[model samples]
Target: MPVPPATRTSPGAKAPTRPPVRRRERQIGGSQRRMADLQPGLDFTNVALRPYANVERMRNELLRCYLLSPPASEIPEAISPFTVQYISCVLATYPRCMLSDGGLPPLVHRAQVQGQEMPRALANCFSLVRMWYQAVPGSEAMVAGMVEQEMERLAGKPPGQGDYILLCTFQAYLLYSIMIYFSPLPNTSALKYKTMITLSELACRTVRNGFSCAAEHSHTRPPWETWIVAASKRRTFVTMELFRIAFNAGRLLPSSVTSELGDIFASGNRALWEASDRDSWGREHDRYLLDWEDGMLNTSELYRPEATAQKERVERWVQSVDEFGMMLFAVCAHIRGR
Candidate 1:
C-alpha cells in the first residue's frame, strides 16, 4: 500500500478526467429536437382583439354590399364614390383576415386571417345582394338558394362564405320592422324553425304580417315589392335573434363566434336602417302615443351602455333574455314609426 502512490503515475502521466469538448459538439442533439417541437407557432394570446376584428371586417362588407346595390333610384350613377371609399377605409383589417385556398374561410380564422390566392368571400356577398335586386317576386327564395349554394361550396367548414348569412339576417330585420309598422295582426305561429322557429323566422312572421296588411290597404301597384321588403326584414330578424342568443351566451361559446355574431348584428341593423326610405313611412301614427313610446326608447338607449355589459357579458349574458324583448320592441317601433 505504501508503494502505490509512487507506482500509480509515471512522471508525465495524467489523472483520469472527462475528455475536452469539441467546438461543434457542445450541445446534445436530442435537446435541439425537443426545442424545435415546442416552437411551431401555435398561440392564442390575442383573443380579446377578435370581436373588434370581426366588427371591422363585417362593417366593410356592409358598406360594400350597400355600394353594390345602391338605392334603386341611384343605380347606374357611379355607386356612391364616398361610400365605397369609406367602407374600404373602415375595413382596413380585411387583408389580414382574407381567406386563402386550402385553408379555413374568413370567419374561421378566430383571431387571425391566413391564406393565399382564394376568391374574395366578400365578392360572394355582393353577388347575393345583386341577385336579390334582380329577382322581383320570391326574392327571398332566390337569395336563400344562392346562400345555400355558397354554404355547400364551403362544406360545413369554418370561414366558408358566411357573409351571405349576414345578408339574410339583415334582410330579415327589415321585414320585421315592416311587420311592426303595417300589420294589425301578429303572425306568431310562423315563428318556428325546422322544429322551433329561429329568430329570423320570427322576424319573417312579423314582416309577413306587415306585407299582408300593406297588400290589403296600400296604394302601391305591385304588392310583391312589399312582400320582398317583408321577406328581407324577416331574414334580418331571424339572424338578430340568433345573434342575441349567442352574444348573451358569451363564454358558453367561443369568444370568436360571439364576437363575429355581434358584429354582424350591429352592422346589419345599421345597414337596414340606412337602406330604408325613412320618409317612406306610409301612414302617420297617433301623434300623442308615438311621442310617448319614443321617449321611453330614447331613455332606454341612455341606459344601454350600462346594460350592454350586464346584458352581453359572460356571467350575466344568458340572464339577459329580457334585452331581446327591448330589441324587438325597438325594431318594431322603427318599422311601425310609432
Candidate 2:
C-alpha cells in the first residue's frame, strides 16, 4: 500500500483517534430496562383516575401554601393588632392538613369542628408549646428537656391500641417540632441538635410500622379509617425529611422529602378522606385504593408522569389530598425550582 503525506497540525493540536465505543455501549446499556421490570399488562389506566370533587377549593389551598405568606387574605381584624402575626394566624386559621388533622372528623357530620375533640396528646403539646410562646419562666435545659420527654414518649414502638394513637402521637410531634423550630424561645437553639435524632427515630418508625392499612381497599376496612391510616403515615414520614432539609439549609439553607427518599405512598382522594360516614365515601374513592404496587403515588412519579396513565386522575389525586398532600406538592415544586 502507498503511504499518504501527513497533514500540517496546529502547534497545540493532538492526533485524532476513533470514538470511544465501550463508553458509549455502557451509557446506552444503562438506559435499557427489562419489559417485565416495566410491569407490562398492568391496568395502570390510572394505574384509574380519581378526580378530586372540590376543584376550586383545592386550587385555592395549593395557592395558599405556595404563595401566601404572612397569610393576608384570611386575616381577621387588623394585622396591626397582632403580637406574632403569622404564628397566631397559623394556629387560629391555617386549615388543617393531614399531619394536623389525624384522619379525624373536624366537622362532625361534615359540619363544624366542635364534633371532634382535640387529641389529648395534642392538647398537652399545645400547653408545652405555650411555655415557648409566653416566655414562661424556664431554663433552656428545662424547656428542651420537656419537649424531649414528650418526643421520647412516642419514640419507640407505638402503643398497643394501634393507629389512632400513632396518628395523635405524630400530630403531637409535628406540633412540637414546628413550634420549636419557629419559636422565639432561647431553647429553640438547644433543640437544633436534638431535632435530627428525633427525625431519624420518626423515619425508622415510618419504615417499620408506617402504613398499617397498606392492604387493598375492601368491605372489611371502612374507607375513612384506611385513608386516615395511610395519610397520617405519609404526612409524618414526609415531614421528617422536610425538617431535615429545613435544618441543613441554614437556620439559614434545604433536600426534598420525596425524591431523596423513595416513598411510594399515595395521597388518596379527599372526599374519601373527609367523608364522615362509610355511605358518604362513595365508590369513586373506594374504587381506587393505594396498592403496594402500580397504584402507589411515588414521589419519583412527580418527575416521571409517563409511568401513570391519566393526567386528570393525577390532578385529582394531587388536588384531593388534604393540606399534608399539598405540603408534599410544595416540596416537589421546590425540587424543580432547584
Candidate 3:
C-alpha cells in the first residue's frame, strides 16, 4: 500500500488516539494535572468559614452512626463509642458553648438574643455526661452537685418569670435528669429514677405554662423565632411524655404528675423541624400547612395504615423523620404494641 509519502495530519484535524499505555498513564495523572493547571476565577466575599471544620467532620460521623440509625431494641449498658467521640469533639471545639453562666456564646449571641441558653446548658450536660461515662475521678460527684445547684436555682425562681428562661431551665433539668437516671454507678437507680420522674413533671408543667398548643385555625407560618420556640416546647413535652411512659410502664402516676397528651399530634411540621434557614423554614412551614389542610397524616398516626397497600409511603415517611422523632415514634410504637 505504498503510495506517495504519507501526508502529516494538521493540528486542526481530527484528534489522534494515544497508545493504550499512554492513555492509562494520562488517566492516572489526569486529576493531578488538572489540579496543577487550575486557576482562580473569582474570589468569594462574605463567606462565613467554619471555625471548627475538623470537629464538624467528627460530629457528622457520630451523627451518621447514632442519630441517623434506628433506636436500638434496648438502651446500651454504656453510652456508644460514637457518642463518646462526639462529646469529645463538642467539648474540644466549642468550649464556650458549655459555659455555666447561662450566657450565649458571642457568635450565637450576635445571631439571636434568645434560645441560646438551652443549647449551652445541654452542651454542659453533654460534657459532664462524657466525664461520667469515662469514670473520671470525681465526675459522679460533680454531676450530683450540678443537679443540686439546678434544683436550688429552680426553687429560687418564681413561675411568673420570663418563659424563655423557664424553658431553658426545664431543658437543662431534663438533660441532667436523664444523665442521672442512666448513670452506670450502682446503688443510685431508685434516687435517680425518682429525680427523673420529678423533673419530667416539672418539665411538663413548664411546657403548659410557657407555650400554648398550636391553634387549629392558625394556618399561617409565624416568624422563625416564635415558631422555633413553639417547636422546642412541643418537642420537649413529647420527649418527656415518651420517657415517662417507657419508664413507668404498667404503673400509673397521679393526674397532677402525668402529662396530658391532648392535641399533642398538632406538633411542629416535619419540614419546619428539618429546615436549615429562615426562608427555607418559612417555605416548608407553609407547604406543610397546605398539606395539613388537605388531610396529610401526622407522624404519630403514620403507622396506622399497616394493613393498607401504602408500603412505599410509610417507608418514605419513616425515613423523613430525624433521630429524635424516630426515637419518639419507636417509643410510641412500643407502648401501643405496634
Candidate 4:
C-alpha cells in the first residue's frame, strides 16, 4: 500500500484530544440542573435562621429576668428554684424534639402547693448544681463553701438522728458528686473522681446506719404516709448502689451493699407504691409483701428462661408508674446480672 501523502500539519502541531470528564464534575452538573428546576422564590434563609435568633433573644431575656429578680423566699423547701429555672432554660433553648414533655415543673408545682419539707443538705446540693449550670464567676469556690458548710452541719448532728434525715444527707452528697463529675468546668477531672469516690463511701455508710433503723419498724405496718417515707429511703439506697456500679463498671464498687431491707428484694411492682388512698395502699402493701416473701417469686427467679415472660409483665407494670418505675426495673435487671 502506498503511504498517503503526509497529513498537512504545521510545525510543532499536536492532535486535539478531549479531556476526561471527572465524576465530581458530572455530579456537580447534575445537582445544578436539579437546583435550577426548583422555584427560585422558595427561599429558606429567614425560615431557618429566624427561630435561632428568636431563641437567643428569649434566652437573654430569661437570664436577665432571673438575675434581676430577688431570690424567692416563699418557695417550698422541697422545690429548688434553680432547678426549675435551669429546666425552663433548657426547654426554651432546644427544639421540641430535644425536650421532654414537662421536665420537673409538675413536681415543683406540687411542692409549692403541698408545702413539702425537703432535706437541707439536698436543697443545698440543688443550689450547687444550679450554680454549676449557670457557670457564674467564682461558682466553684461558692460551691465548695456551701458543700463544706453542709458537711460540717452533717457532722455536728448526733449520730442517732432519724433515718429520714440521714437518707437525705446521703442523697445530697451523691447528687453533689454527680453534678461536679459532669460539670463543664475544666481542670476538675481528678477532683470530680475523688469526690465521687468519697461520696459513694459516705453514702454506703449512711445507708448502713439509716437502714438499720428502718428495719426495726419494717415488721409493723405503718401509716400510709410513714410507709411512703420508708419506701423512699429504700429506693434511694438502691438507686445509689446502681449509680455506683454503673459509674465504676462494678470494678471500684462492690456488686451489692449490705442491707436487710425487704424492699430491695421485692418485685418491681409499682401498684403497691402508686396506691392513692391509705386504705388502698395498705391493702396493696400486704399483698405485695406477701408476694415478695413467697419463695417462688424471689429475685433468683428473674434470671431463668421462663423469666422472659415476666419481663413483659414488669414492663406493663411500669406503664402505670412511669419513668421512675422503669428505672427501678432497669436497676433490678442489672442486679439480677441480666
TM-score to native of every candidate shown: 0.21, 0.53, 0.53, 0.49
Model 3, 9-67: lDDT tens digits are 99889767767664432221123233222222211122211122233332232233213
lDDT of each: 0.30, 0.45, 0.44, 0.42
Which pairs of residues have clashing backbones in candidate 2? 44-47, 249-253, 249-254, 250-253
Better of 2 and 3 by lDDT: 2
Please, what are the lDDT tens digits per residue for candidate 1 over residues 1-338? 45655536677889667788756522221233232232234232211111122333433332332233434564231223343333233222222222222221112211111112213444454354345334556455655556445534433233322332333333323223222222212222221122112332333223322312232223232222232233333334333433333322321321111122221212112221222222222222222123223221211232243544433332222222232333433442332233
List clashing residue pairs in candidate 4.
Answer: none
Better of 1 and 3 by lDDT: 3
Candidate 4 lDDT over 196-301, as tens digits, reads 5455445544444333223223443555544444445555554454444444431232223223322343333456554434566678767655643422132333
> To one decimal, what is the Cα RMSD in angstroms of model 3 from the true structure?
17.4
Q: Provide the lowest-lDDT 10-residue window in model 4.
A: 44-53
Q: In model 2, how large is the Cα lDDT of residue 258?
A: 31
State in Å the error of residue 121, model 1: 2.4
1 or 4, greater by TM-score: 4
**Tens digit of lDDT per residue, candidate 2, span 213-295?**
42432323334444544555555555555554554442322122333244345553456555443455545454554322245
Q: Which candidate is the best by lDDT?
A: 2
Model 2 lDDT-worst window of ten: 42-51
